[model samples]
Target: MTTKKIIQDFYKSEAFINVSEMEPYLHPEFILEWQSSKGFSKLDKQGVLDLTKELSASYVRSKIRILSLVQEKNQVAVRYSHFVKTVENPREEMLLAHFFVIWEVKDDKLYRGYQMSQIS
Candidate 1:
């Protein structure tokens, strides 16, 4: 698959809370640098997996809307909004965050990512 397609699919899987499906797309050394309201954190692939699993326990559902996407060579940049509904308040959906991320593809898998997010 194309790098762009792979990146897009990753986001889709995340929204669906399919962490296991997302793993195959990641390189062993995959890492993400995240900048957020709290501060910055560097996360390895396992860290991301753990985070997602934790989030799944609190949120009943989630959605991702990609506002912009661009791919150059093996790199992709994306801007997206994330929405989620907590298990305690399933009827009310809330904006989780807005994100801007750049991912580097290696061996047809996501090798590195850098992202910033604004919490809502």
Candidate 2:
């Protein structure tokens, strides 16, 4: 698959709230450097999985709305918003955050990412 297609699939897969589903899209040595309203964090593949696990416990499902997507070679840049249905109120979907991320795909998996986000 193309790099852009891989990234689009990853976001639309609800992998953010389904930890097990995300593993296939991540490189073994994946790393994410993130800056958010809460602050900055650096996460390795395992760290990302752990965070997704926590998200899975809190959210029943998630949706990613892609505002913009651009690809150049093995890198993709995406601007999107995340919406989630909480475990407490699965009937209601709420905006979770807005993000801009640049991802490097290696071996057809997400290798490195630089991301910025704002809580909604």
Candidate 3:
């Protein structure tokens, strides 16, 4: 698959709500360097998996809206927003954050990512 397609699939996937299904989208040595409204954080593959598990437990469902995507070779840059239906009010979907991420695809899986987010 193309790098852009890989990223699109990952974001559109239910993996955020089902951690067990996320492994296939990430490389064994994946690393994510994230800068968010709160602060900076870094996570390895396992850490990301654990975090996703926590997110799955906290939210009833999650959705991603990709505003733009660009690809050059093995790298893909995407601008998107996350919306979630929290356990407390599963009937309402709230905008969680807007994100800009650049992902390096290696061996057909996401390897390295540089990400930034703004809380909504």
Candidate 4:
């Protein structure tokens, strides 16, 4: 599958329902990044997993809707709306942003990825 397809599948995977299903899209050295109103930051893939694990307790569902897709060379930039439902709050809210992701893919392995998400 193409990178886009793989990424889309990751969104639809059971991981969104149960955090443990995240294995397919996660690599040991994985990295995930996103910006808040404060500033940009970095998270190792483990950090991403940890965040999800913690969130699983409070957030019942998570979903990403692709708004746009742009690809050049080995990079893919995707604009999306990240939707989440808080277990306690029970209200779903969305944060719209675009992510710039650069991946180092060697054969079937994804060695690393750097991602940046900005408010849109």
Best by lDDT: 2
Local accuracy by lDDT, each model: 0.88, 0.95, 0.93, 0.63
Write one digit per residue (lDDT tens) for candidate 1, span 1-120. Answer: 999998888887753455776678879999999999999999998887788788888998888889999999999999999999899999999999999999999998989999999998
lDDT of 3 at 73: 91
Ordering by TM-score: 2, 3, 1, 4
Please identify model 1 stretches exceeding 4 Å from their true place: none
Q: Candidate 3: deviation at residue 103, Å?
A: 0.4
Clashes of 1: 0
Q: Which parts of model 3 have CA positions greater than 4 angstroms off?
A: none
- Residues 42-70, candidate 3, lDDT per residue (tens digit)? 99999899989999888999999999999
What's the residue-level lDDT of 34 in candidate 2?
100
TM-score of 1: 0.92
Q: Higher-lDDT candidate among 1 and 3?
A: 3
Model 1, residue pairs in steric clash: none
Error of 1 at 1 (Å): 0.4
TM-score of each: 0.92, 0.98, 0.97, 0.71
Deviation in angstroms for 29 in model 1? 0.8
Better of 3 and 4 by TM-score: 3
Using TM-score as the yardstick, the better of models 1 and 2 is 2
